[model samples]
Target: MTVNIPQLRAFLAVVEAGGFSAAAADLGMSQSAVSHAVASLERELAAPLLVRSAPVRPTALGERVLPYARTALTAVRSLEEVAADAAGAMTGTVRLASTPTVSQGLVPQLLRHWREELPRITVRGFEGDSAEVAQWLENGTADAAILIDPPPGPGVQLALDGYRALLPRDHPLAGEAAVDIRDLADDAFLISPNGCEARVREIHRLAGVPFAPAHRVRDLATLISMVQAGIGVTVLSEVSRPLVPCDLVLLPVEPRTSRRLVLSGPRARRWHPAVRALAESAAGRLAAVS
Candidate 1:
C-alpha cells in the first residue's frame, strides 16, 4: 500500500486547523476535497483518524500519527532545501517563544551573537508567560520555547535558575545580605498575575505565611515598576532583575526559591539545527547571567 502525500498533508492540515473548512482554506482546496482526503487516509489506515464533532478533534490514532507525519514532512522539506542548496543557500527563519524575562534580557544578546555567527539564520521571538510558551510549542506555532516552570510531561528539557527579591531602593530590606521570605510576610506583596501566582504561593508556604497578594501584574517589568513605586515587594528570577528599572534593587532571597526554566519542542534533540543553535546560544547567555 502506497502512502499518499496529498492525503497525509490533508490530514495534518485538518489536525492543525481543527476543522475541515479551515484546513481547506489553508490547503487552497474546497472543504469537500479536504474531507475526501481525510476519508481516504482513514480508509487506507483501516482506522478512524478524526473525531468529527463541533471543533473536529483528532482521535488517539490521529494523535499518534500526527507527530510522525509532521516529522516526515519536516524531513522532506529539509531535503528539498538541501537539494536546492547545492548551488547556494544560507538563510532560514527560526520561530521561538519565551517568557517575558528571557525575551527581554537573554534573547537580544543571543540574537546579536547569532546574527554575527550565522548571518543567514534569523531569530524571530514571541513573548508570553510560561503557559503561553508551552502552548505555542504544542500547537506548532513555535519551533522552540524558553519557558519558566513548565508543566511536567514529555518533550521538555529542564534548566534551573535561582530567584531573588526585588525591593525599592529606600526599602530597609535592601540593605540586608539576604532576606528570608518570612521577613517580608507582614509587608504588602506584589505578584505576577494569574499564571505565576504559584511562585508567590510557594514563597509564602516556605516562609510559613499565608499566600496573600496585595497586587498582581502580568510581567516582571510591571511587578518591578510597582515595587519601585513602593506598592509592594515581589520575588523573581535573577535573570529578570537586569531588565527591571534601575531604581529597584535586587536582593538574594534566603533559603532560595528557585525557578526552573525549560527549553521545549516537539522533537527535542531532533530539532532543526538553527533551532538547536539558538537554544544553545540562549542557554549560554542565561548561564552567564545566573
Candidate 2:
C-alpha cells in the first residue's frame, strides 16, 4: 500500500477542482490519466476518496487524509523551490487564504504590493469565511493566510479593524457621531454570520442588550440592501466602510472594539520559500512604515 506524490497531487486536484476533467486540465494530463491516478491512490489506501457525483466531494476517510496530502505537497513544492532560491530569484505560487471581510478590505493593496516586490511569485487568493480560512491554513490548503483576531506568533499584524454600526441613512442614530449598541436594541437586528457574530454578541452583552438577531445574512451586499430598505441594522468592521452604499451610514460603536488581522504561514507545516519571502517583504514594509 505505497502512495506516491503524483497520486496525492491528483487526489487533491480532483477535490479542489470538483471533477476529474477539470483536474486533468489543471494538471495538464488527460482526463483518463487523472481518473486513473485517483483510482490507483484510492486502491492503495483501500478506500474510496471521492463520491463521484456531479460535483465530486471527499469521503469521510478522504477528509481525514486531505490535510496530510496537502502538507506533503507543500514539502515537495519547497524542495523544488530550493534551486530557485539558490539562483537569487524566487519563483512559485503562494496560495493565500483570507476571510470575506479581509478579502474585500485589505487583500487588494497587499496583492498590489506583492506584485511590485515579487513579480515572479504568483499569489493566488482563496476566499472563505473566517472558520473556513482557518481550516484552510490548518489543513495546508493554503500556504499562507491573513487571519482575524489570531493569537500572537511569527505572523505580522496587518490591521486592527474596529466594529461599527451600519444603519439606514434616515435612522435616528445615523446622525450621531457614535451610536450605542443599546440604542439599536429595539430595531430589527440583521446579523452577518460570516465572522462578526461573536464580536457583535459581545457588543450586545456589554451594552446590556439581548443579542437576538431578526435575520442572519451572509452576503455583505444583501446585508447592505436589507439595511437600506430599513429592514434592519447590522454591525460590521470598520474595514467594511468601502462596501457600504452611500445611502447607508456607518457609525462608530460607543465603546471601541477591534479585531486583529495577521499574515502568516500555515500553522501545520513549514513555510514554502515563496510564502516566507512574501511574509518577509510584508514585515519589512511594516517596519519601515513604523
Candidate 3:
C-alpha cells in the first residue's frame, strides 16, 4: 500500500510540535482531521505510530519511520524544483566553484558566452583549490564546479592536464628536457596547502623517496614567488603554465601523470539545471579545442 503524504506529514508534525492540537493549528487543519490523518497512516502501515499520552509522543515504530518519511518528502520537493526549472526559460543565480587555474582560464570566457544562452540567469563564481571546490559542491555552497582529479562517478571529464615540474630558473636541473621525480629528493618541496598534496606524495612514493614538503602555501602566486626565490620546487598542472612567472621553469615530469578537469555538481543535485548547463558548456568548449 502507498504511504499517504498528507497523513505522513500530519504524523510528523504532531510528533515534532509535541501535540496533535498544536500540529493541527500549525497545519491549518482541524484537530479531528489531524487525528484522522495519523489514524489513517497507522491503518495503512498496520502499525501503531503514536502513543496516546498527555502531551503526545511517538511509538518505537514512529521514531524509526520519521527519518525515512523526511527523506522521501525531501526527494519529492527536489523533483518538483527540477521540473519547475526545466519547464521554462530558466533564470536564477547559478553558483559555481572552481580551481584558480580554471577560474582564470575558463570561467570568464564561458560566462561571457553563456549569457547569450540564458540571458536572464546570473552566474556567480567561487575560486578555490580543487579540494575546496569539491567541498563547496558537496555542501550545497555551489550549484556546480570544475574540479581537478575528481572522484570517478559524479563528474564528467572535460580535459586532461599533465603534471609538470616547477623549478627555479637557476636550478641545476632547469634546462633538462624532463625531471625525474626522484632527482629532487634532497631538495625542499614547496606545496599548495589547499590542493594536490595527495598526488605529489603519491609520486614521491612511486619514486621511493620520503615525502617532505618544505613550504605550504595556499596562494598560487605566492607559491610561485617562493619558487623564484629558490625556496623549493613543486609540481602543478600544465594548465597553470601561462600564469607562471618568467623566473620559474616548468619541465615535463617523468613517469607522466595527469589531472583531469571535470564538471560536476552535488551528488544529490545531479539533475540541477545549472549543473547541466555547466556540463554542456564545458563539453562544448573542449570539443572546440584541437
Candidate 4:
C-alpha cells in the first residue's frame, strides 16, 4: 500500500509541535483533521504513534518509525530538487549541521564563498554537539553536516584537525614550539563541558594527570575570553586557531591528537543538489581558513 504524504506530514507535525491542535495550526488544518490524518498514518504503518496526552508524546513504535518517515519525506524533497537542478532552475536552501568550533568562524567564511560562487542558492545552518549533529542528519533535519571523526559513512574528507593548547599571549610557554601537558599542571584551567572536553581529558589521563578545570564554560566565545584574560589554559582543535583573540596564543600540543573532519549526509551520502554544491563550495575555501 502507498503511504499518504499528508498523513505522514501530519504525524510529524504533531510529534514536533507536541499536540494535535498545535499540529493543526502548523498544517493549517482543523484539529480533528490532523488527528484523523495521524490515525490514518498509524493504521497504514500498523503502529501507534502519539500517546494522546495534553502534551503529545511518541510511543515506542512511533519513535522507531519517525526517522524512516523523515527520511522518506527528505528523499521526496531531494527528488524535487534534483528535477529543479536538471532544469537549471535550482534555487533552494540546503540545511547544514555543524559544531560551534566551525560554526563560529569557518562556516561563515564558507557561506560567503558559497554566496559568491552560487548566488542563486541559499544555505541554512544549525549548530549542535557532534551527537546532536549526527541526530539531525539521521532525522533528516539537515541536508548535510560537518562531522568530526564520525563513524563509517560515504563522505568527503575536508580536514584533519589537530588539538592545540590555548594560552595567554605573554605566557612563558606560549613561545615554545609545542607545549607539554605537564607544563600547565599547576595553572587554573578553563574547560568546556562538551565537545573537546572528553578528548582533552583523555589525553591528560594518558599522561598520568587529571584534567581538573577551575572553570567550566559551554560557549566557545566565553571559553576564549577566559583564556584571553589569563584565567586559564585549555586544549582545542587547530581549526579554532583563527578564533583565538590577539591576547591569546595557540600552540601545538607535544603529543598531538587530531580528528578527521568530513561532510556527511543521510547514510553518509548526499543526494540533494544543494548539499553537493555546498560541499564543493566549502572544499574550495580551505586555503582561506587559518
For model 4, give the RMSD to the true fold.
5.0
- Rank by lDDT, highest first: 2, 4, 3, 1
Q: In model 2, which regions exceed 4 Å deviation?
A: 1-4, 20-48, 59-68, 287-290
Alpha-carbon runs more than 4 Å astray in model 3: 1-87, 112-119, 128-132
Q: What is the lDDT of candidate 4?
A: 0.81
Q: Which has the better TM-score: candidate 1, or candidate 4?
A: 4
Candidate 1 residue lDDT tens string, 1-290: 55677888899888767899988876779999999999998998999999998788999999999988777766665674565366454456676788777776666766787788678887777777777777767656566787776667433343456778888878888889888888887788887774456765777777777877888787566677778778888887777755878777788886667776676665433455566555666556656667
TM-score, every prediction: 0.65, 0.86, 0.65, 0.74
Per-residue CA lDDT of candidate 2, range 1-290, in tens?
79999999999989988899988876779999999999999999999999999899999999998989987887787777776677766678788999887888888888999999999999888789888888888777777999987776778888888999999888987899999988887899998887689999888877777889999988888898999999999898988888888999889986568898999887756677788889898888888788
- Residue 209 lDDT, candidate 4, scale 0-100: 79
Per-residue lDDT, model 4, residue 69, is: 80
lDDT per residue as tens, model 3, 1-290: 87878987788779856799988876779999999999999999899998978778989999998877766655654675578576854555576889887886666767887787667767777777766777767755566888876667766786687888999889999999999988987789989867567877777777778888878998888888888888888998787787788888999987677878877877765556655665676567667784
Best by lDDT: 2
For model 4 the local lDDT of residue 270 reads 46
List runs of model 4 lying over 4 Å from the truth: 1-72, 88-90, 268-270, 284-290
lDDT for 84 in candidate 3 is 55
| TM-score winner | 2
